[model samples]
Target: MHMNTYSEATTSQLPIPPTMDEDLENNTEVCDGNNAMTPMVRKKSELVVVANNNSRLQMLRNFMTNLQEVFFGTKLVVLFPAVPLAVVANFYSFGRPWIFAFSLLGLAPLAERVSFLTEQIAYFTGPTVGGLLNATCGNATEMIIALLALHQNKVHVVKLSLLGSILSNLLLVLGSSLLCGGLANLKREQRYDRKQADVNSLLLLLGLLCHLLPLLFKYALGGGDHSIATSTLQLSRASSVVMLLAYAAYIFFQLKTHRKLFDAQEVDDDEEKAVIGFWSAFTWLVGMTLVISLLSEYVVGTIEAASDSWGISVSFISIILLPIVGNAAEHAGSIIFAYKNKLDISLGVAMGSATQISMFVVPLSVVVAWIMGIRMDLDFSLLETGCLAFTIIITAFTLQDGTSHYMKGVILTLCYIVIGACFFVLKTPLIGQSPKASFGVKPSFEAITT
Candidate 1:
């Protein structure tokens, strides 16, 4: 009886099949040949995958936020619209004068933002790299304009613009900085590092020597000789190479071996923070440069037309107006720092810019022109070269004592005014024509009347 009961229990437990609903719910597991249940993998839903992707896109939003922070909230930001306006005007063949005006307005903020971006990058790089970056890109507008003019075979424009940059930074910008600084600090003595001033002065003298040699070569050997022109061109090219080498050495001296001498005047401000990432600053700098190049091309193309329309000489337009507009942002920065009694930064902005233009930009323009098969000599004509020489001499004397005052600033500013007035009245033909050619004998009145 016990054996029969056990057999009945075993038979009952042998197989109880699952219901249809239970089979459907439990189908994720499968019974293999060995009767072992194996689990099957399943994919996530489409909605869940899309949610993960959306989260990753937040980086784009962060970039936009940073970009707005960097570009907005400044008075200059209002001028940004002028950039596109200038582009549209250029495309639609709007008046050349309008294009010129819009381009200048557009360039002002770009130049300022360039400086701001460079400062932001400097936060990551040490001051040495920052100084080098400033030296390279400080006069980028001038360099771009000069290169564009050179490409157009407007060598005269290149010479005038570069000369104007040197003069502007040295006389106008520095003079204004000193003036504002002196007025702001009435009781305190305004002083700067003499070593830095002296080094820049010496470099200026060297650049002057390079410039003067070619002019003297032309006149000393008689300009009537064609060989003299060729010789002057050759001399200018050779001098440009030498000047570039000297500038490189100056960079080494300033940033490496003798860096302490240059850093004496920097104020350590703990409050200053970088507003953008290094890569962001770099990307913006590149974009700004490209925009500047486009505007610069417009400026160069329309300069003569603007001059004709405005009743201004091309020389005046290139020398006085262009520099004022191109360096407006930098000029303001130097003055502001000076007003805050940070004379070191002010001098670095003004004198450092001047030195870079003279030693680097001017020479670089010549070298680039040489490569383009253009004869861009260093002989800046008698009038322009004389002004540069006088400006340098006076500036050297002003900074010789390392002490500055409103009186000194007054003198420098007056000198710039005088130079501007001289250019305003001076009438010269466009590039490829001699200044003396314009003064050639005119036809008799009777001949014209006939």
Candidate 2:
């Protein structure tokens, strides 16, 4: 004979007391082992206890995370669950560009908001939380898109996306920032961020090698499609290991030799006054990213659907369209920074973001794609390779002399605008009305549409 119904006092005393965060706050019970509570109970009771414990543990973990955020910082929120949200959003079929555009806008505010949060967590520790958050969100969005592309076997599209993002950050973000900074002062000179520069250059070199190696290897192997993507993934993993080690070395050098480099960050004094602390802001960011990602996915999906109806190539879409959408937010902040005469920091942001992507994001995507049995190459196509080469060359030229001029900004921006126009009209020059399992450039637009 068992009492199925227990009194409130006894129930509270039972090991299976409710375990919600707020609900647990009221409970006076503490776990003290089998002696303190009944060891043998109904299986249902045991399940209840387990559920409560799990919830309590999660609450504790979140609290600990809050404490860490108080001391440390955070990453991009709108992109935290980008893949999942994108998958859902892609199910929608209209207004995709706006969705994607909204996601792009997420970058700037995310950086600004997170920086404020991290600064607060550190008790105004002097680092902008927004920088890392923006990068994180950017990386997350890139990878999610990469995965979707890979899942669809759009290898060329993936390369285009990578190149487009790099170019957007380099030319658009950097150029706009330089333009603003230059206009504020007739002449703008960049100071030496030697540590950051060295790391950036090294990563860029590594990324180039990752791109070059498999491409050359494939060309040597008669340029067959088979295993080209696979080989690229393997090389990406190797490069990731090398570059990660380099980053570790950079961190070590900063710690041991130039500690001030870690601190003495260049932040906007005005922005700082209005910014909230890290954890408080980060909590809000978590919610925002979710909403934004949802929106972004819808945007991408709708655009894609419309594109499918309009017969647009994903490669052209990524190269021209995605860039406009993705970097919209960060570009605004970069321009402001430039206006505030933070040219060096702007260059660092542009170059640093690209270097990190090439060295870390691309490689990690390869590994993750591999694990998921998706083929993601570490290499780029001829056009993509050409674009990367062009970007690096122009970037080096732009930053080489440590001076940024307004004319240069005009040049870079105009080039981007021209490219955008070409993309819109030429439309990746597709061919054939029917979708082919194996992709080859179609001969003409008429062939594609008909």
Candidate 3:
């Protein structure tokens, strides 16, 4: 009987003890092929071991099942699983610039996954960590594209894209968010903390001013004289360094000194409500970043080709198309939050991203160019500078009252459209073009630079 029990436990895939109970050993014997006797466990002892083994196995299986449910449960897993297929598609279509571009666009959703994971992590870590992570990764796509463009000495494209990013965030994304949120809450006014929003807008205005200084220095003293150009470049490099320091201080003010000012809610709760585990969030962030980097390379490689083939200016490509592509994540998040009536978070996404691009990413590009010996100056064209200044001031004006209506969104969006159209017709930039040589109109230095 004891032998039978041991045999049943073995066949049932339960772990068996090395030795059986002494009572069973005294009572029972097992025989090998040569009729050699071996000690066997008693039936009761074998049953006890089997029961414990089954319990352990059951617990492990349950744990695995839960893990599988959690990890693969999200609808986003559908996209994650397609990443391998996208990679293969990109490789197979390597020679076709259009196909490569299409594949790169497809990879954008995967990059957006990083944003979702960051939000999840933030939910658990609190708003500060979450906001910081979002800010860092928010422009990952743009930063990657700019750095790659810088590597190829495509400084013009980089500058255009930087302005494009800021405009897209300020006008397109923010406008859409406000419209959606206001419409969704049409019965009541959609409001955000004007005070917090104004701080960022002020910072944006400061950044825009800093950007204009290089241009002012160049044109104010006369056209890009070799010595003046040299001075402007040096000044730009210095300004970029200072801007980076200022950005650090701004972050300190927002996250440390006056976090409550930016908090979406009055409660100071630190409880984490995110469902994603730490390991899972970290893994996804790293993986998605790699994918975005690869996709950005393909996008940059094809940008000029696409622009030429489409008969669109490279500036237009960078200013409009590239910003839309790179900012896909934030654009989606902003609209989604707006639809959900989370206007505060929605506004934060738009305003905060715009501010970061202006203060942090733009300055970093200048510093990176200086480091790489690329003669990148912040002397934007008059049209570009004027558009930016006008947009920032108008946006600041809209935010001042703390209330957003769908009509206001329409107005902001219309302004963006007009500006985009002007850029579309803007002349392809000359290497040393005067400020007067712009899109059909020539504004004085005061109007253009200031």
- Please state every model's RMSD to the true fold in angstroms: 5.5, 16.7, 11.7
Tell me the RMSD of model 1 versus the true structure.
5.5
TM-score of 1: 0.87
Candidate 3 stretches greater than 4 Å from native: 1-96, 265-272, 430-450
User: Model 3 over residues 137-191: C-alpha lDDT tens digits?
Assistant: 8788888889988998888878889899999999998888888777888897677
Q: Give all TM-scores, in the order shown.
A: 0.87, 0.65, 0.78
Q: Highest TM-score: which candidate?
A: 1
User: Global lDDT for candidate 3?
Assistant: 0.76
Model 3 residue 199 CA deviation in Å:
0.9
Candidate with the larger lDDT of 1 and 2: 1
Minimal lDDT window, size 10, model 2: 430-439
Give the Cα-based TM-score of candidate 2 against the true structure: 0.65
Ten residues in a row with the worst lDDT in model 1?
A: 441-450
Query: lDDT, candidate 1, residue 149?
Result: 91
Question: For this target, which candidate reaches the highest lDDT against the unseen true structure?
Answer: 1
Error of 3 at 99 (Å): 4.3
Residue pairs whose backbone atoms clash in candidate 1: none
